[model samples]
Target chain A: MNSDHHVILRVVSKALIPVIALFGFYVQFHGDFGPGGGFQAGVIMAVAIILYSLIFGIAAAMRAITPGFVRGLAALGFLLFAGVGVWALIQGGDYLDYDALLGEEPGGHHGQHLGIMLVELGVLFAVSGSLVSIFYAFAGRVSEIRDEDW
Target chain B: MLEFILERGNYWAIIGLMMIGLYIAFAATNLIKRLVGLGLFQTSIILFYISLSRIDGGTAPILYGADLESGHGDSEGVEAVAEAGHGVADAAHSGAGELVNIYSNPLPHVLMLTAIVVGVATLAVGLAIVVRIREAYGTVESDEVQEMDLSVALAEAVDEVGETQAASGAGAI
Candidate 1:
């Protein structure tokens, strides 16, 4: 690869990742408001990382977003979400009843909002992790074989 | 009415988009086309769920209290109680005009958000597999690969049978 092209690719990857991540957060938070939310944001964020991998090669991208850490984060996020639902159930409420979690608020909507936020955080973690994993799996493969048996 | 258009129209549009995407996925023989179909299908479903959350005349569900008037407008409480038919006519009547028309339902939006994430992840994995397929086969056309693989399997089967017959005849001798 040309040095100039390599530099440009690196720069583009570095530049776009933060902007994409910021947008993902905005989508996740503003989801209650409009046409975006946690899943979309997570995917978009992952796509940015994938793009970086595609441009700069898998090693660089992997270095930037470590696989083991992401896997743990994703698992933790899922557990947190499941924990909330279980907590609600344990409180003598219907499985995921947000009101039970809130424990008798003025209105039940507050609990629903809180539950959703927590779930969204979980979703974000899982998405970001899965996406990075996909990139790593593909990018990790050696494209060319030097050993010749034929 | 504005409410009908926003609520119903969005649903129909999303369904239509989903069907078109699904059709492409089912019919397309090209890997990229299938991926495109998958993308379309995923995106349309996301749109569908997002649309479900919108309430006519309802603002974002923010608790700012600044635009509370423009939000649900406290009209729904009365209508809901009246609709429950607890014999509370006055409560229903008072809040009737101020009620927001089911502008938002956050649950579906949340689910769809997850759906969107899953969809993109699936697409990424699919595309990666397609890349590997293209690398190995020098083509990403499904029909072509299937035909080739089928032919190769048939040939191997025939060769195996021939060898088995030759061995049997030799044994008999």
Candidate 2:
């Protein structure tokens, strides 16, 4: 039951979604120097998409991002995190030892910074994917109830 | 008593919020309302931890320019470095330029971030399950679900009894 009306909402959402997505990326990458982080960024990213779906309808949203792809994306994101840890192990360092990721200044926190960045990327991917999938699941259940049934 | 109350006002508010959230989450019949209560409880808990970490006249938990120039790390010979850093930080704090070493614990804030993510996931999954329940049972009420379950149980029990009776009657014949 996507409202074909609400011309104002549609226009505003179209303008806002890109800016919100940019803000999400900013939060994801600038977390070390600032307050925002993967979880917050992921939620914000999901919110923008959900808002799009809210205005444009689930059919359009699904076409943009299908349910199956979303599920696979979530799994891949988790694997990316694990793979980073395993890469550390293969590099002869402890699991998730970002120090092993590069040969920067050993005393500095360069390696740790790299590792954290990678891990946060994984977190962003998995979190956003799961949220989108959850939204898709909730939205697809239209047969569960009619609008006035409640 | 008044002094104690004033000193711990934040904590008291947090506790009050917690109790209200718990009451609605446990006592409410509607699933969505219960989830909202859970969200409220989570907000209060986050606030409570944040309050605990607040330090009066403290700045952000970041090493300032002075701190960086002085150099600080989780290194050995920490006592010497700590003494040096402390003296500089203290002097800066009292100086006209304005600097402070006092910072609220960052660990609690970091841990709470993880907790919030977990809480959100739990809420989302819980709501999804609620939706499925509505699909299956055509109702989201806990009492209605229980009643449906009871009827299903009663029917199974009656079926079992009928099978035993038929078996016994055939054996007697």
Overall lDDT per candidate, in order of appearance:
0.75, 0.82
What is candidate 1's lDDT per residue for B68-120, written digit by digit as tens? 56445444564466466754557645545553343366578657655665666
Model 1 ranges off by over 4 Å:
A6-16, A33-35, A51-56, A105-110, A144-150, B1-28, B38-115, B128-138
Model 2: CA > 4 A from native:
A1-4, A148-150, B68-100
Residue B97 of model 1 has an lDDT of 51
Candidate DockQ values, in order, are 0.33, 0.31
Docking class of 1: acceptable
DockQ of 2: 0.31
Q: State the lDDT of candidate 1 residue by residue for A49-127, as single tens digits.
A: 7887788777877787788887887788778778889988987788778878778532336678898888888877776
- In model 2 chain B, where is the ten-residue run with the lowest total lDDT? B71-80
